[model samples]
Target: MIGIIDYGMGNLFSVSKALERIGVPYIISDSPEELNKTKGVILPGVGAFKDAMARLQEKELDQFIHQYVDSGRPLLGICLGMQLLFEESEENGRFQGLGLLKGRIVRIPDRDQNGERLKVPHMGWNKLHFHQEAPVLHDIQDGYVYFVHSYYADGIDEQALLASAEYGVQVPAVVGQGNVSGMQFHPEKSSATGMQLLTNFAKAMERSEELL
Candidate 1:
């Protein structure tokens, strides 16, 4: 079973429904103890970075997350949840993050290199461009996924970059390193491509269990 970390700021409804459609067992909870029992954990969020970190610290879920990843289990962050995996974000001002992955989150450029005006938030579907291999991306091909955020990750090491999308700038879309991975898109709402990614994650979790 998968544990969807509910730190009072997750898109719990959509995420849970998506998992259900794929037949992946999941439980939602704010208690780290309850979540710790699951085979894998998913950190999903839909709010401000500063506020999200504050909540995680309040519940000590931040420490729980670090411990969980250190145990060799899998952890996947989605959307704002994905950004929280980084070291810091410049959303409302510089603020520390979970630091599970290297890099920082910043606002998408208002203009491309050509200085042409570009849209902020970047809401809608964008095609994914794969960079490296990952279990979560197993058998996954380049396809469109739903994205709805203004900030994107930057300065990420090449090894951790799994995929990206062009949106006035090269936005880090899918990122992973070892037992941890993240997606900037809403896979649950992203049609067949999204479902495939989640299914792949489930398969990866099963493999991790086997190793234990």
Candidate 2:
């Protein structure tokens, strides 16, 4: 079964629904034992980084998550959950993050060298463009997906970025490295395009297990 870590402050319903629709066996739980038994884990959230971290810590799932990451099992983080995979975020007074990935979160640049107004919270339907080809993106077409965030990860290693979207500036839409993956957009709400993304992730998890 796939494990959805329900620490607190997650878009739990939509994410759970997406997994169900994809016919993936899954459970949402804060229990470390249940989480450890799962074939793969997903961290989904639609809230502040600080608050989510607090809930994970309170539930004592933080260390478990770290151990799982080191196990080389796939662990996907969605939206704000993706931000928490990093070292720190500047969302509210330089709050620290999970440091699962080597990076820091910061606000997107509003102006390019050309000096144009780039809006924050880059919401609405935007195209997902792959940074470089990877198996996780297999059969995944470049299409529109929903986004609802003001800040995006910056100065991250280019190798970790999987896809980007235009929002006055190129925004990181999908990110992955080794066994960890993330999405800045809400794949659960993006309809066929979104469902396809989740399905793709499910397939990726399945493939990882076969190799083991």
Candidate 1 lDDT at 206 equals: 89
Return the top candidate by lDDT.
1
Extract clashing residue pairs from model 2: 121-149, 121-150
- Among the numbered candidates, top TM-score falls to 1
Candidate 1 lDDT over 138-176, as tens digits, reads: 777758999999999999989999999999889999999
Clash number for each model: 0, 2
| lDDT, each prediction | 0.94, 0.85
Candidate 2 lDDT over 100-150, as tens digits, reads 777888887777658887777787898888788876677776588999988
TM-scores of the models, in the given order? Answer: 0.98, 0.94
The per-residue C-alpha lDDT of model 2 at residue 129 equals 84
Q: What is the lDDT of residue 82 in candidate 1?
A: 95
